[model samples]
Structure formats: C-alpha cells, structure tokens
Target: MLRITAGKLAGAMRGALVGNSTRVAAVRSLHGTEESAEEFDKRYEKYFSREGIDGWEIRKGMNDLLGMDLVPSPKIVEAGLRAARRVNDIALAIRWLEGCKYKCGDQMATLYPYILEKVTPTLKELGVPTLEELGYDKPELALKSVYDQ
Candidate 1:
C-alpha cells in the first residue's frame, strides 16, 4: 500500500493542479541523465507508492496544470527558495532558480538578483560562478554550468 510521507495532501493536490502535460514533459527533460525506461518507471512508481496516490491521478493532475499554460507564480518561487535556504540545499536552490527563470520571464531580471543574493555565497562555497556570470539565459545551460563547475 502507498503511504504519504509528507502528510501534506495539499501539496499533492497542488502538484496535481499544476502538473500539466507540458510541465510533465519539462520535468522529464530536466532528468537529462540517461536512465532506462524501466528505471524511470521504477522511480515514478516509488514516488507514487510513497505518496499513497494513484499514478494515473498524479499524471492527470500534471496534465491539468500544464493545460493552464502558466509558469509558477512568484509566490511559489519564493516558497521554493525559502525551502532551499532552510535546507541548505544548493542543488535544490539552483533547481528552484532555474524553474523561476523558465516560468517567470517577466520577473527574470528581478529574480536573477534575488537568486544571486541568496545563492551566490553557496555557489562560491561550491566553487561555481554566480548565476549572472554563468548566465541564466537557458535552464539547461545553467544546470550544466553548475554541474560542470
């Protein structure tokens, strides 16, 4: 039987509400490292199994979110940043920044500054260039820059 570790039904619901097909495809693309289809299925199965939710429901929810054709709001981006900060997870912080770049183009100029302020120290500690230096023009490129650095 599946069990939800997060105990946050709202998170799952929100995920469903925002998980559109496009976003799902984007997420899949984000998993760029080569992995077999079986591996991907296993990973998703584990995710759904742990969430105590039906896989189809989750996929449907993702599709619904994608249909909205909206990027994540600033509020969501801020929340993700806060979470990353709290966890001291640089990779997660970078991921959130990348998401903000993808979804909030209007706020890109402002967002980059904010992310730089928060992530710069971490990046320096990890011997990576600032987001501005690496250039946040492309999410995939930014991710690679971070990974390569």
Candidate 2:
C-alpha cells in the first residue's frame, strides 16, 4: 500500500526536495522561528561550498542569492566565487559579483567598499575581474551598438 503524508515532516521533506524557498519559509514561520542573517549567510555559503557543484547548481545558487532581499556577506560572495571558479565559469562569476554590487543599492557608497575590502584577496586569487576592469562600467563607451550591425 502507498502511504501519503500531509504532516509537518512531509512539508519539511517536500521543501527540501522541491527547493522551494517560499514553502520552506512558510514551514519555518509556522514553527515560530526564522533564520538569522548570519545563519542565512552561513547556510548559503555552505551550499555554495559543496564539492562537485556543477555549472547549473552554481548559476542556480547565484540566482537564488540575487533574488533575496538582503545583500550577501563577503564570505558568502567569496565562497560563491570559489564555486564558480571550480566550475570554470569566470564570466558568470564576474556577473554574480556585479549582481552583488547592484544589490548594495543605496548602501553602495559605504557597504560595497567593505565587501570589496573583504573579498579583494579572494578576487585576486581567483583572477576574477570587476565590471570596471572589463570596461563594462561604462557601457556607453562602446563605439558601435549591436543594433547598428
């Protein structure tokens, strides 16, 4: 006979298997507790630091972090970049780093520098370039647009 479960345990398992953040969040809230920012960042860092993480998972992880409301910690960014490098994806790695800077928003002036300070060594170690270094910081500088072709 097949068994069906609609209990909290089932929801937890489903949340884990489905990788649905909303459902996972609902389950946590229903339990009267939510993860702290540090815990959240640590969890993501651990996720990204997993061995044998493929390109799809790396992109998915970056997208998940980007979709979040808060900016990721420098350690998390470093971990993600390391993962990206592991998957041989320097281009996507740069994009993810840029996404982190964009996430800084109004705090870009203050917080971005701190993130850069913390992650600079890792960036250099991984040989990942920032948008500015790639001349992406000024897209308007392009002499010819793709539309002009």
Candidate 3:
C-alpha cells in the first residue's frame, strides 16, 4: 500500500491551515493497485486536506514514486535539484540530503555526487565555503568534509 506521512503532507500543504501540523500520521491504501506518482500526490493532498486527522501515529515512509523501493528515488533527487535551482533554500537541500543519507545508507554514495553538484551553487549563495575555499583540491574530499559536518 502507498503511505504518506502527515509531515510530508504538511510540507506539501505549505501555507494551509495545518493546526498542530508538526504531528505525523500515515495514510495507507486498503486495496487496489498502487497509483502513479502524480495520482498518488493528488490523493495524498486530498486526504490530508480534510478536517480532523491529528495526533496520529507517524510511520516511516516516503511520498510519491510508487515504483521506487529506494529512499532517494530519481523523483526525490529531481525535486531537490529543482528546489536548489529555484528557491535556493540550503535548508531544504540539506534536509533532502540528510533524508537520503539516513535512509539510503550505503547506497547514498552513488547519489551523493549528483546531489552535491545540484546544491553547490545554492550552498555557495548561502555562504558555505566551497572545496577550493576550504583548501580541498578534490571534490570527493570536499564532499566527505561537508557530509561529515
């Protein structure tokens, strides 16, 4: 079943009137085949928008990308890239990276470079020193240093 956490729903809801929105809840499908990413997002917003549904138990899960078994799916990586390009929100990019790092575990190495490349400009805009500025001659070393921090 496709499930979504209330926190992710709230993030999607953005400026909606999410009273006590910090709480997390998981909504799952009872039956029927999993929906497409677009359809799932539509349904998730619809379910979360309804009145009530607060203080529910928060289960670990991801949003959209039904076919994906991995945490840092291409959709998520793209979303982070888009955020970096448009909003340039360092916190958002970092949160995405942290989520992937925490959930993807050893698999994160494969995706880390792509994420770092996408977010580097935003990080620079946010005054985070680059690898060159930090005296790291190599991007991989700089990535490790930044990841460690």
Candidate 4:
C-alpha cells in the first residue's frame, strides 16, 4: 500500500488515485494479461473523467491539502517516487520521473535518473547526481538556495 505524508486526507486520496492510475496502465501493458483491452479502457476512462466527481473540486481539494499556497509539484513528485519505491516497481518510477521531467524540464537533471541509470550511462559519466543528492551534503541548504531565489 502507498502511504502519503500530507496532512489532509484529500492529498492522500489524490496520491492513491494517481498511483492506481499508473498501476492500471502498467497492468494493461503486460504481456498476456487476463483483462481485456476494452475492459481496461473502460475502467481507466471512468477514473480519468472523474465521472460523478468534479475534477476541479478534486484539484481544489489537493491544493488545500498541499497547504503551501502554491501547487506543490515537488510534493507530488516525492509522493509518486515513494509509491513506486514502496511497490518495488522500476517502470512506475520511470513513469513518475518522466512526468516530473515534463513539469520540471528535461534538463533539470534530477528527473532524468531513470533514463540515465537504466537506459543509458551517459549522465553518470557526466557526473550528474541522482535523487540521492538531495539527501546528502547540506541538502536543506542547497534546496533553500533554489527556493529562496
């Protein structure tokens, strides 16, 4: 099960919803899956549309749960990474990293580890740091430098 650290239940719910979406997508792509493609599409479409629920309302709820007075992309990325790690799913991690790359920028470096480590070693050869960098060598201070500017 995925765990969310955000104070609000809505944030947790959103995280779970997103994680489930990812899992469903992965399962459908597996070879010789038991679920029919049509069935998988129907289920995913229902969740994607937020049918009975208001999509904007859920977005608002997530905003409130974040409590940072801004849409916290970092928090979302952290949650996704944690969920992927919890499931021991590298593909999920790659998906989450791709999403982060889209949001943060392709050259952001931090979001490219999945590609670098698994797909290619060029980044490591170039001396790029992985997410582990955020946990080492005065990370809080380094992060503050980015956020403070």
Tens-digit lDDT track of model 3 for 1-149: 13558777767778554533433222234345776877654554444333443312101122332225655444445444343334444444444445554565576566655656765665566554434455442455334456575
Clash count per candidate: 4, 0, 0, 0
| lDDT for each candidate structure | 0.51, 0.87, 0.46, 0.45
Q: After superposition, how far is residue 138 of candidate 3 from its true place, in Å?
A: 15
1-149 in candidate 1: lDDT tens per residue? Answer: 13464557768877787878668889888886896656644553344334334434444433443245455443334434444444455565565556545554677567656655665555555544434565655465334455575
Give the range of the ten consecutive residues with the poorest summed lDDT in model 2: 1-10
Error of 4 at 43 (Å): 22
TM-score of each: 0.31, 0.72, 0.32, 0.25
Off by over 4 Å in 3: 1-30, 35-69, 81-88, 114-149
Candidate that beats the other on TM-score, 2 or 4, i.e. the better one: 2
Off by over 4 Å in 2: 1-28, 142-149
- Which candidate has the highest lDDT of all? 2
Rank ordering of all candidates by lDDT, starting from the highest = 2, 1, 3, 4
Give candidate 4 misplaced runs (Cα > 4 Å).
1-72, 105-149
Q: Rank the candidates by TM-score, best first.
A: 2, 3, 1, 4
- Residue-level lDDT of model 2, residues 123-142, one tens digit each, is 89999987777877676656
- Clash-forming residue pairs, model 2: none
